[model samples]
Target: MVMEFPLLEGLSPVERREFIAACTPRRFRRRDIVCHEGDPGDCVHLITGGRLVVRVTTPLGHTATLTILGPGDMFGEQALLSPDARRTATIVAVTDATTLTLNRSQLERLRLQHPQVERFLTTSLAAQVRRLSASVLEALYLPVETRVLRRLAHLARVYADGAGTPALINLTQEDLASMAGTTRATANKVLRELEDQGVVRLSRGAVTVLDPAWLATRAR
Candidate 1:
């Protein structure tokens, strides 16, 4: 079956077909490490199902989650630009997941055949850079509560299933804390406050965003 990707939006039918044909599908169980930081980057993955987290570790052994990604998101694109590029962050499966991967060689060949492919990759990389920059700025200036709210809002937006249902973030408080660069205790406190305000409903291992718009406003 042919899978559609947002990154391939501008490609012609033939180009899309060729790109899909070149891709190899891979699956991972929950908690599986897709790639580790500092490892040789070999392929770019476009998530086809479930969710994953992008995390980084400091030299001092501290680890933090940079972001959560779901279907339609792509990762490991840096490899396509440089042969010696290494993974900048670790990617781990948040749930049982599947992805369509394109190796460096296949992507290089496709870029020569279709200039738009290169443009797509460049655009994706730029977006990633902008996101990282924003995260740095937030960490430097925002208070812990605001940072937590912003991170929760981001997850809600990414994982929202259309059909008018509320967005449910299937993650533990510890995971949310890591993503927000806070302690689990602090995250739990903020979540309880949000729950009292009717912004979210917290259950074991999950948070249901009841008022995403309100939460986003508070995040700002």
Candidate 2:
């Protein structure tokens, strides 16, 4: 079956098939580093299964979680734009994950053969910018609790396994704290409160969202 990628939404069926044919499949185990920040940009990866986190480290050795991505999401697209580009963030697999990667040479050939390829890249980058902008705004104005709730809500949606199955977020308090831009202690406190309220069930290195709808409502 042809896996539908959000980044390839604009491409025609033929174009998508051609693009997929050019890609090479790669897999990583949970907690494996897919790519590191400052690594040479070689290819773009489209997630086929499981989840991954994009993170960046500062000069002071502080790291922040930018986002968690699931099936259909694409990353490392900047490599398609410039040959001199380096990876801007490190990507680590949150679960055993599979991706289809297209190297720069393949991308160049695709762009020449399919005009929609360029459009897809442009759209993908624009969407990322908008998402990052919203994240920045939330950090600047939203309260810590609200930010934490929002992150949980996002994780619930992204890591949802299936209907009638629990939405389990496989991340530690430290990882969640980084995503919410707060301290680990603050994130733990908020999660404990939610657990007390029957909104979530906290366990070792994971959180089970019991009331995802409530979290989504309060996240706003």
Candidate 3:
């Protein structure tokens, strides 16, 4: 269940321990909504055990998946740095899991009290900036299939062990379509194409990359 946990390797042991101490641990069941779009940004979540899907709904009722986050990944930290911030996306638990929750005030205090925490936030935010910039470019310039494939490669990379052992990305066609800004039928067709070419193996909600190199090519 702790698979694909993001590494907070830069944080020192004492800082990590203190950060955890300042948070409240809570468990969530599969598909539970952790935070809704437009909600007051009250708490930052440190995913200790679980996956989260970040999504946004457009005016036409179409939803787009912004990203998927796993254990050791934190969210809502921007709220701690901004006084008038609201949640920009809805976060839902993709599995039954536990997370440490820190309210805005607590997180702000922690940032002030620990330079290591600040460093962690800075690194995380820098990564986010790069990711968001790439996302914007993908949304504007990439084809739907290319965009979906890019996300698949991202999930594969995230779920894989550093040694390159592949793992299934547990998500449905509809979910993939949402992430790619397309219809489920289109996403299913794309998946079938990849599967036919031995690029990926699909079963129910799980997709395993059979040829990551091929998938990576399509991702670009």
Name the top TM-score candidate.
2
Q: lDDT tens digits, residues 149-204, model 1?
A: 99999999878886658998988899899888899999999999999989899999
Q: Which residue ranges in model 2 land beyond 4 Å of their true spot?
A: 1-3
Q: Weakest 10 consecutive residues, lDDT, candidate 2?
A: 1-10
Clashing pairs in 1: none
lDDT (Cα, 0-100) at 209 in candidate 1: 97
lDDT of each: 0.87, 0.89, 0.78
Tens-digit per-residue lDDT, 1-220, candidate 3: 2232243556677767777788898899999999899998877787877678899988898777867877767788777667777998999988786898877677678778786777766776887798789878988988887988987887776566457666678888888887787788999999999889888889988888877877777677
Residues 1-220, candidate 2: write the lDDT tens digits.
Answer: 2545766767788988998998999999999999999999999998999899999997789888877998888898889888998999999998899999998899889888887778878887998899889988998999999999998999998988768577988889998998899999999999999999999999999999999889999999
Order candidates by lDDT, high to low.
2, 1, 3
- Candidate 3's TM-score: 0.80
TM for every model, in the order presented, reads 0.87, 0.92, 0.80
Q: Candidate 1 — worst ten consecutive residues by lDDT sum?
A: 1-10
* Native-referenced Cα lDDT, model 1: 0.87
Error at 152, model 3, angstroms: 1.0
Regarding TM-score, does 1 or 3 come out ahead?
A: 1
CA lDDT of 145 in candidate 1? Answer: 94
User: Candidate 1: lDDT of 8?
Assistant: 70
What TM-score does candidate 2 get on C-alpha atoms?
A: 0.92
